[model samples]
Target chain A: MHALQQKIREEGIVLSEQVLKVDAFLNHQIDPQLMHAIGAEFARRFEGTGVTKIVTLEASGIAPAVMTGLIMGVPVIFARKHASLTLTEHLLVAEVYSFTKQHNSMVAISPRHLGADDHVLIIDDFLANGRAAQALISIIQQAGATLAGLGIVIEKSFQAGRAELDAQGYRVESLARVSSLASGRVTFLD
Target chain B: MHALQQKIREEGIVLSEQVLKVDAFLNHQIDPQLMHAIGAEFARRFEGTGVTKIVTLEASGIAPAVMTGLIMGVPVIFARKHASLTLTEHLLVAEVYSFTKQHNSMVAISPRHLGADDHVLIIDDFLANGRAAQALISIIQQAGATLAGLGIVIEKSFQAGRAELDAQGYRVESLARVSSLASGRVTFLD
Candidate 1:
């Protein structure tokens, strides 16, 4: 967690008061050692939670989720942002709005991968408005699966995402929490 | 490699003569242990090749690429399939056509992540018509980076992907090669 926070401070670019770009290491270009550490940390945090599956959105979420799944010895399921030709029928779909992109995309998962017997842990790269997280939670609910917990690499604490999830009674753990990205600088939450 | 072949035989679904759906492990719902094995195999195959970085497309390619990067002690960069708001200016872009989806998408990467001194190893989930591989190769070329090799998790040998890359004089290593999927049966290329 310290390493991640340090990396964000070192390489994260603050585009605006609301945008932080971690293209140098976290998302576009990744540091595998840091990813492994984050995964280990998540696995440790949820060690006794009996997590049967790790769910995440595609693209950025795959690395951390896969690493967590590897350490936790569970399967990782990534919801597709776009509808695929192969991914049709028995699908659990949820519409998610991306504040950054300013649009809504339907995220879907095959129900065959998730079931009522599964305990699912959600992992992702960034948490901002919590729209994506809510969409994943919706899909998990549709499958009648139990929510183990949510693991996020970076959270924009200035936003209401964490508060909403907390209010909803979901346990969310984030490795690096950015309190502010004011004046082209990053401030971490204590 | 044997384990991968066995997994394909057991869980891989052949939708048609050309399409093999490996959603059970390699993509949508991933088996983390199998992915680790794949990364180890790729690392073993590309050992001591002076690979400074691992490159792949987003979504499916992230897991294996990150695992290989972890073992090989290098950075992993995934080209974004769609244009990102933060990813603007000084971009190396290539247009790639997806055979299964019947669409063309422009893939882009930041020039800050890749450089002339870097040696890149391209990794991907599947190799079919070779368009994606070609696009990645173009990006590497644009950056003046050296191509170490190409590592593919599954190669449809019946298609022109392998032949095209081979013709282009790129060294390609595929963990599992399928010779045919006729009559809904997967035949490995021995």
Candidate 2:
């Protein structure tokens, strides 16, 4: 977590109070070693929680989620952001509004991937508005799966994402939680 | 590779005369153990090639690319299909036509990720028309990087993808190369 916070302080580009881009290492272009560490940390934090699977959204969330699943030796089911020819019709669907892309898109998971017996640990890159996390939780709920916990690489605690998820009684662990971001500077939560 | 072929044989759904969906294991609902085997296979195939980085496209390609990067001890960079606020303006861009999505979208990679000195190994889930590979190749070419090789999980050899890359004189490998798919059955090339 210190490594991630250090990287954020060094290479994280804070475009505005609302937007912080870690594209250099986190999302678009990834540092696999850092991802491995994050994954291991997630595994350590969520150890012995009966995590049957790790779930995430497409694109950015896939790397950390994949690494987590690899470390935990579990299958990773990343809900598709867009409907493809391969994805079937019988899916648990949820609408996600992306502040970054400035649009609402559907996130879907196959019913076959999750069920009442599965305990899913949701993993993702950034937790800002918590919209993506909420969407994945909804998909899990629709599948009648248990929410084991949520793991995030970076959380904007200044936003209400963590607060809302806390009120929802979900156990969430964010490796690096940013208390505030302003003027191209970031402050991490203790 | 045999394990992957076996999974395809058992779980892969042949949807039509041409479309074979392995979303059960390869793309959508991912099997981490299978991906580890795949990453090892790709490493073995491209060993001692001085692959500084592994390149892939967003969404589906991230899992395999991440695994390969983890095994090869290199960074992984995936091109973005849709531009988000995080992606910078200075990017290496190429147009990719998705047959599954039935549309054309622009793929862009950060200039910060790729450079003249880097040797990149491209990985993906499927290679049918080779449009995705070609697009990634163009992005790598734009960055003046060396192409270490290409690794794909599945390839429709009956299609022109492998042929075009072969004509281009690049080393390419698909773990499971399908000879044909018809009447809900698949034939693989030796």
Residue-by-residue lDDT tens digits, candidate 2, A77-153: 99998888878679899999988888999999999878999999999998989999999999999989999999999
DockQ for candidate 1, C-alpha atoms: 0.90
Clashing pairs in 2: none
Measured by DockQ, the strongest candidate is 1
Tens digits of per-residue lDDT, candidate 1, B38-128, equal: 9999999999889999999998999999999999999999999988788886799999999889999999999999999999999999999
TM-score of chain B of each: 0.98, 0.98
TM-score of 1: 0.99
TM-score of each: 0.99, 0.98
User: How displaced is residue A159 in candidate 2, in Å?
Assistant: 0.2
Q: Quote the B-chain TM-score, candidate 2.
A: 0.98
**Worst window of 10 by summed lDDT in candidate 1 chain A:** A82-91
